[model samples]
Target: MLKEILVHCGHSFCKQCIQKALGAQQQSKTPYSCPMCKLQLGPILELQKNFQLCSIVEAFLASTSKGQQQPGRLSRGRRAEKGVWG
Candidate 1:
């Protein structure tokens, strides 16, 4: 799912993607920046998880999966093709 990480520039990204970017920056000894705006966001360690967005995501998933056999459980291997967050 869209695990939220709040960038200093007020942009949000999926936590996985942010972590990957941050890891890349660490290897390159560069500053972290918002992927969308390219605005410098300082250290990745300074960022905080956006709980509001996270709750929204959780709610959406819960609502969407209600009719399924296993509520809130996404089918494996079906997500990648749909680009859905699990």
Candidate 2:
């Protein structure tokens, strides 16, 4: 059976392929290029998706949108201490 993971390019790659690419990246200083397209994968961390099996398009959007949010951002202050600003 072929175990697969989602690629940043909205494509499916076998788990073996992903591991191989990551190993190549770790062994060498250069980024690992995609086997099929030869596109450099910046970071293996960038390749891992927040959602498993999610389409790359959706995953990319989600990653860009809220990945940088501060933890407890809105809950930092009590309702009585601050009024609604936005």
Candidate 3:
């Protein structure tokens, strides 16, 4: 039996046992347990990075800055009325 591990789900099992369990699940409605260790496999931890999400935030800021070129217009004439020297 080949030992296999799924990093995303944090579960390790024998390859043959996993295959047989999958087959049984597909073939009929039956509860299957890990044959080697009998550990109830639950959801695995999904490793997610925030780099892509941060990039999206940065892109939104860039676009907003482009649209804010006319600053006084956005401020509703408040800066102009107050005689603010830009």
Candidate 4:
């Protein structure tokens, strides 16, 4: 998702969605618009990748996966049974 993030008129969208929107625009012969702000994006090729947001998302996901893989953490039910706040 973050790997191919695209930005248009200060809004971000995934690459796949942008591609689909571009295709639709092409068929309609209309310009692409930002999904969030509805601002016109002149050209699909001109769309820029938001590398900073991508990097942050990647890091957050990596940390989340690592946390899930660790076996030391107790489940919510078990913690509650042990008198630990759930």
TM-score of 1: 0.67
lDDT of 2: 0.62
In model 2, state the lDDT of residue 12: 64
Expressed as tens digits, the lDDT of each residue in 1-86 for candidate 3 is: 13343422334444565666656754675444344554544333222334445466577668767875544454536667878646
- Candidate 2 colliding pairs: none
Candidate that beats the other on lDDT, 2 or 3, i.e. the better one: 2
lDDT of 2 at 24: 81
- Please state the error at residue 83 of candidate 2 in Å: 77
Worst 10 residues of 1 by lDDT: 67-76
TM-score of each: 0.67, 0.42, 0.29, 0.65
- List lDDT for all candidates, in order: 0.78, 0.62, 0.50, 0.73
Pairs of residues at least 3 apart in sequence or in different chains that clash in candidate 4? none
lDDT of 2 by residue, 1-86 (tens): 34557666556676777778778877987776666676766655455542465455565567657755456555325434677443
Which order, best to worst by TM-score?
1, 4, 2, 3
Which runs of model 3 end up more than 4 angstroms from their true locations? 29-86
Which candidate number has the best lDDT?
1
Q: In model 2, which runs have C-alpha deviations exceeding 4 angstroms? A: 48-86
Show the lowest summed lDDT stretch of 10 residues, model 4: 1-10
Per-residue CA lDDT of model 1 for 2-51, tens digit only, reads: 67888887888788888898889889988877778888876646767998
